[model samples]
Target chain A: MIDTIAKLNGIIQILALVLILIRAFLVVRDLTKSVTGVFFMFAIFTHLSADMYYLIHIAMNKGYYPPFSAMDLAALGTYLLFGAAAHSLFPERTGERSETIVSVCAALFAAANVFLWGYYSGAWFQDIFSGITFIYLLVTSSQAVYRTGALKRDKWYILGSIWLTFVAGQVCVPILQNAGAVLAANAVEWLNYSLMFGTFLWLAAKVILCARRTEKDQALALSFGLMCWSLCTLYMCAEPFYQLALFGETFQLLLMWFIIERRVKTA
Target chain B: MIYSENIFICIVIPLLLSLLFIRREGFRFVLGLVIGMLVCLLSAYISAFTGTVSEMGHEQVAVYISPVVEEIMKILPVLFVLFIFDPPSDRVFLFAVAVGVGFATFENCCYLLSVGSQSITYMLIRGLAVGVMHIVSILFATIGLMQMREFKAMSLPAAFGAVIVSITYHALYNLLVSEPGITSVIGYLLPGVTAVLLFLVNLRLRIRVKT
Candidate 1:
């Protein structure tokens, strides 16, 4: 089972990376003109870089040094670009003052998280940092939803509620684990993952029905698909089951594919 | 941060009492001065607070947090004026400059008060370095806001971009000054150089437009 998961993950990861590179090439060839599209490109690039770093590091060694690896830069950079993308996704132009605020805040937050997490050298520091990121993501996503008036539709609420539930479950996981309720913790985690999967499917459905044939829809669908698969791989993996590397590569390929599709359409 | 009733008595009350002495014509400048000091105070308090919250010590706080806090604090009054009164364009520049200078002066006073230094050389350096740095930083933000105002209305992005410029300048200055020797010398000279360049550019633009 471990070997199978690892193989599956490797295939997905390589495919994703290839797709992202192809999409980047298409973007270079004047495939899409959207600002969000450009941001998506950067986000995908940095995210893939971080994912690739993880894969390479896992393959080479056992222990990880957060600072030495320099993956946090890519991870945090991706988050910042994602924030910018969310803002750009809106049709309406934001006022200069607010944009300045957002840009500064985003920069500060990313810099602080990456460096602080790298330097802190404490157990659970990474998890704590991840929690902070999730909170930040929640805040930014809600702001984007509100600012873009994406909440006018009930789909946002549905996705948001499910996401919130999953996060809440994540928050409770440590407590459950620490209390030695391993089975209960696993049950809650799996339950939350199921909800998250449902939310992703819902989001992808919306993207398909609403954004059909567009690069945005394709990107969204591809991301959701990769994330679902990655989580599944994680579920199947154990201490010796190293599938994260391939899952990461698969992500890269999916984005590259989106880019290529846009190019072909424009061509 | 000796922020107590003593501060209220020494700074706030005296400023309020002095405000009564000024006529309506000079009242705005005085108000700007007092508000600028208050903004500086806020910057100190908030920077310290955030530094503590973020688990930063003195040096880290000074290096990382102070720039963000001080830049934001210095610009608050300008933001208020922009949002509330809708002051005329040229006059708005004057108001911003006043606030900047006032902020710097107050900050200088606080620094001297804390250090109890009487050296004229130190005062001159502090006046030119820290004071002018504050002024220049505020100017960057205000000018950005003003230019954006002229172009497409002061947007959040433009304002945020301005804040970024202001913070970057301030942070760079702080980091440079935190070092000793030549770096500190460069840091001290940097703001004055920037201000001169800015002035020359404005003058040149005015001349070009006149022709």
Candidate 2:
């Protein structure tokens, strides 16, 4: 039964990769207007690279690791890919020297990760790269949302990307090392996977909703709802320390959603 | 000694005063306290969970953990006010400040409870610094929201710009405080200066609103 479950998990991951690849291909073809389509393609690349890295790590433990592993290459590739996607999505505005500086800072951070840590420590390198990339995405997406005046559902896109990159890039991998029990690590892993997948689902939904009804208020509500759901879930699962994180996120989500909805309805 | 009880006094007294003195604005008052407490509890919880439940240690709290958690917590009330009342009054800036004060007051209480009369001087410095910083950051975010409301084109960038600014300010503050020597004192003083500047900006915005 355990074997079956493991196999099932593997298959699901594989299927997700395939879906991601198809999306990437479609995006490359320039056939989809959906912003999420582009994001999903990149997400898939990151997701696949991460999964492959773990698979290789596991194989090494079993004394069957392959030389010239795809995982390492994928890790490097995804890091650069994220930077490229972010640059393309939110190109520098004319006369915005500050943004350009920030973008350059992001690139330098990514490069540092690859040069300093990529060769010697796969896990550490990936974490650092992913962390920088997460911040880059947050800054980039927030810029896109701001520039486009697509405020309604854009919050979800920005928040989703931030959460996914931060959780996967910064927290999950490091925590897995000292997780003590396999169960804890596995749970955290699953949670990480769910967050990434959930982000894709959210971005896709926002795109469709926006395309269907260009109503600004509806878009805002949708974004707020998506953020709220994610925040609420995080709040429920978060254990031990109960400072201001969960409540703050939940309140922000709820407030944004409610305000947007009211504004639209009243208008 | 005075600063030891400041947290409880700051949080509870204001809450009671608002409940009694500002009965007409009861919702705002209560909302302020509730949201303030929530942010404090949540940040502490996240810091604790990542450290204990996740067993990730203090490093995680500093690097991957605190930046995202603290920024988001600080912004929640401001975001809520923006969404709900959409207060058309020029006092939106003041409203934002009120929320910030509420948040800082509660957080001060928490810190006071934990530290317990370490040094009145240190406590005052920390309280004033954190309190002012919170107000300034939220006001920045409020300005973004207000700009977005007025100019449709600026909404997205302004809103996000607000968040980034807040985050940047927060990260810098943390970095300064984390360092030893003169940086901590500078960190403590900087937010107050920033708050005064923010107040001026708010005043200017109010003038524009009137015009």
Which candidate ranks first by TM-score, i.e. highest? Answer: 1
TM-score of only chain B in every candidate structure: 0.90, 0.77
Q: Report clashes for each candidate as comma-separated counts.
A: 35, 21
True contacts kept of each: 0.00, 0.00
Candidate 2, A12: how far from true, in Å? Answer: 50
What is the CAPRI rating of model 2's predicted complex? incorrect
TM-score of each prediction = 0.47, 0.43
For every candidate, what is the interface RMSD in angstroms? 10.9, 15.3
Give the Cα lDDT of each candidate: 0.57, 0.50
Q: Over 4 Å off in model 2, which ranges?
A: A1-267, B1-21, B24-27, B53-64, B89-91, B154-158, B203-211
Question: For model 1, how does the per-residue alpha-carbon lDDT over A1-267 read when each residue is reduced to its tens digit?
Answer: 775566456546645755765545434434223444445554554555455445543543324332312354344445444544444445354564644444344334333433433433353456455434433443454445444433344644454355446546755665799999999998986776566455545544544443354544334433433343333334323334334424443543454355335544554
